[model samples]
Target chain A: MSKSILFGKTLAELNEICKQIGLPGFAGKQIAQWLYQKEVYSIAEMTNLSLKSRELLAQKYEVGLEAPIKVQVSADGTKKYLFQAKAGNFIETAMMPDNDRKTVCVSSQVGCKMGCLFCMTARQGFQSNLTAGEILNQYRSISEWAEITNLVYMGMGEPFDNIDEVLKSLEILTSDWGYALSPKRITVSTIGIIPGMKTFLEKSNCHLAVSMHTPFEEERKKLMPIEQVYSLEEVIEHIRAFDFGLQRRVSFEYIMFKGVNDTPRHVKELIRLLNGLRCRINLIRFHPIPDSPLQGSDDETIMEFKDTLNRKGIITTLRASRGQDIYAACGLLSTKELVKKQEKDY
Target chain B: MQSLNPVLITDSQPIANKAFLLQFNRTFIFKPGQIIGITTQKEIAPRLYSICSTPNDATVSILYTIKEDGVLTPQLSALKAGETIWITQPQGKFLFDGKPSWWIATGTGIAPFYSMFQSGQKPLKLIHGGRTQNDLYFHQEFQALTDYIKCCSQDSGNGIYAGRLTKYIDEQESLPPHINYYLCGSAEMVVDVRNLLIKKGAEYHQIITEIYF
Candidate 1:
């Protein structure tokens, strides 16, 4: 049986898997091609491998894409799919359809670790990183399969902390023999993880968007706990090293809060902090969730804030809020549905 | 879990060593810069990719770059035309509003602003930057949008400005006052340009930036 090396298996792990299956040593790359490139659903589809090799693979490992157990459609075209994972825990993925494109939002972890004060997924805490297959299935199990045009890793967790698995999934998504998307189409957002940011910059050609809701370091910590460990200052410092000067883009996600981070002082400070960096600020209207300490800024305030940034010469715009009525907007997603199912099981 | 029907790969190709352009027919409307989800015929679903082409285009277009040791790209490469795949609808806030203006971008960051130029909304100037001449995608299309299409090549020798876009704009003795700077590309470039334009006394209301990375 080929051992299940779907997690963070380095090249050495692949070599051992190949040796046990009695294939030539170089076949490890071929295995990688299948796992990361071809992204086949089963060993049967590994036609390039010998029958004996395929048999050995089938004995131990199973390709990871699992189907969602249930699907819920929002009034708007957003559809959320729920799936039960290896340990019986569940996660959800969202599919949103617009005129020219189909966008699927996928989860990286069963739950999230970054306890941003307003996020429900963060309230669930971290479960575990998803296997490459499980992560891949979010794309595989949906309608209008042939019409998808873009991908954003903005669903459930902090992709950077789950770096290895996320990187592998990204490899499969962009590999020449795999999903083969131009890196520009795929954007992975993080709450400022230094190590992961560096790795992503060095490795992936895909775009990067940082979750920088507040330019002020101290105020930012109130909304996102990770601000303590990896300061926005450090995140910017690391990003500045790489030249996004060309096609590569760096954007800061600024969620506007009514009386909190949306003041003229706040906007001016945002301009001051980002004075030297070449980046854009996405002024996201704070999505209201139950018991959140913050309230969303009024449209007027958002516009004024955007005006200040634009006036100051930092390109800024208000991000349109979507899926709010369905608890599907930013920071509004909850696994309470799964929690209810678990209570039923009990 | 039910097995998904095969993904219909409408078209796929490697535009660069790690980037790809995957096209498919959309039964729905998609606005430019909206990120949509995709499920391959093999049953693997990845996150949303931003739409590059204008919604008016018949076929949907996605421009993506390869991730190092990433999984999605390899799978995307194996696809051929006519294979089944899953795509979500368009989603995002980065697009041209009714206000007419100039468009600026760095590298592949030019994708979102692609529609802005295609529409020919108003008098426009597209200033794009890349490390080399070949890195510039959609150059001719941008040139068609404005007579002042400035290409800033940082590494390769085929441009007037050898360094950054900010440097080139800084040297602009007389940019029109009403010109709205629609900037896209890397965060660093966006930040630098914003700071410089403001320092040079450009009004913040006249500048709009869509962060690419």
Candidate 2:
């Protein structure tokens, strides 16, 4: 039997994996406890299984928990962990410790295909989609696994682009037979790929965060190329139509670029665009990447913009600049130094 | 996903090795660069393909290369004429505006440009990259354009450029910085070409890319 990683399988999938090798179906839950809750590094650590069953499983499967090959600690207590993908490409994950909530940002793909102009990941292009195991390993393999309170899919690649594995990881994370964490603590962010968003909304109860840089179509088109495919208007309309019950939240992420998106006019347009929506806007400070055509808005400008939006009754919050010294702009360190460029198909 | 409707295949012509032009009866209109999702079974999620046929054509055509391990394309290529397939209504914002621009593509990424060409919207130049001559899906049709260059890394002669598309562009003195550079290809191709173009003086806004996931 070919070896398969037993890290990120949902309860049903775990059941299937167990039954395929002639184990009792209930062993799936026991395995899930060891794999997710206990965060064991080896299948042998699953001591509840019979010695014979352990040998049977060890013949085919292993608890594949890969730790970060490299780590850079920011002065602000943000640690950027680098893990190698299955294809030998490197993916970055950031673990940020704030007050009481320790949020670990996970990447869904090795590199990203969505070429947002300001993103360093775009320059590296796309490498591959991470398996459900790869996504969860960023959370489980880290030393802070037990203390982590929230997980956000907001790192290297667009979460919605690799939706299946992302949803599977979510299922394993929240299933009572699995990690049994609250879905509200996990948020999946995207550049608003509608089909994936629709599927995610229908299937999962995780909070949704949309990266809406600008309200105007042409302006956004210049900022994020995804605007050309799924227009923000269509995305907003879709979000409006979907009923995200009170507990489920949808927030817009606006990365402030100096002269491009921060202005009185943009603030007004954003207000008009997001009117009547039970959502808030999160203004993020853009960290400048090498040869970037964009620069982050000055703090004074960002503060003024946030004030204007908040004064107008649109709740807006500015995200603190974390891990700047560590090049935490997701993909900066990996693409610049670590990525082993694979042979191109073309 | 948009609601899929059953459509009958009218013709399934093998254009190149492992590649085919599948034509189905057209019921609704679509823009030249728009894409439609297609699947052999209604219950399965349809894979998206650019509409390769012009709007006025009675039948809608899509050019696809068969991926041996792909869930949809293998079954799709094996499908014959008179077989029914499920397809979504044409929806995509990669719309063509008949602007004078450079169209860069590789493999079956040339589908959208072919539709635009068939629709009478000519590009200033069409630069297509393919590993082999067989990889160029519609080089013969594109020959009608004022400027059509085939960058074939494997295939030679026949007036084709003797290298990859990125190399061909690199050999040039300078690519025009003002005109639009529309690229449709794999993510690697798009990123590499876009970076090269930017390095060669073309501004970011002058470039538009549609990358396949």
Best by DockQ: 2
Write one digit per residue (lDDT tens) for candidate 1, span B1-213.
112333356788877656688888766776665556666644454444667766787777777766566567677767778876766545445556656566767666677766555654534566777655555666666666545445544454433456556667778886777767666654345545655676676654466655432
Question: Would candidate 2 be rated incorrect, acceptable, medium or high by CAPRI criteria?
Answer: medium
In model 1, the runs with Cα more than 4 Å from the true position are A1-16, A24-40, A330-334, A340-346, B1-213
lDDT of 2 by residue, A22-104 (tens): 88878999998888888577878889998888889899898888979999999999999999776668889999999999999
Candidate 1 has a DockQ of: 0.01
TM-score of 2: 0.96
Q: Each model: TM-score of chain B?
A: 0.80, 0.97
Go through the candidates in order and give each one's DockQ. Answer: 0.01, 0.53
Model 2 per-residue lDDT tens digits across residues B8-112: 999998888888999999999888988888999987778788888999999999999898867888888888999999998887767666666999999878998
The iRMS of the candidates, in order, is 16.2, 1.9
Model 2's alpha-carbon lDDT is: 0.87
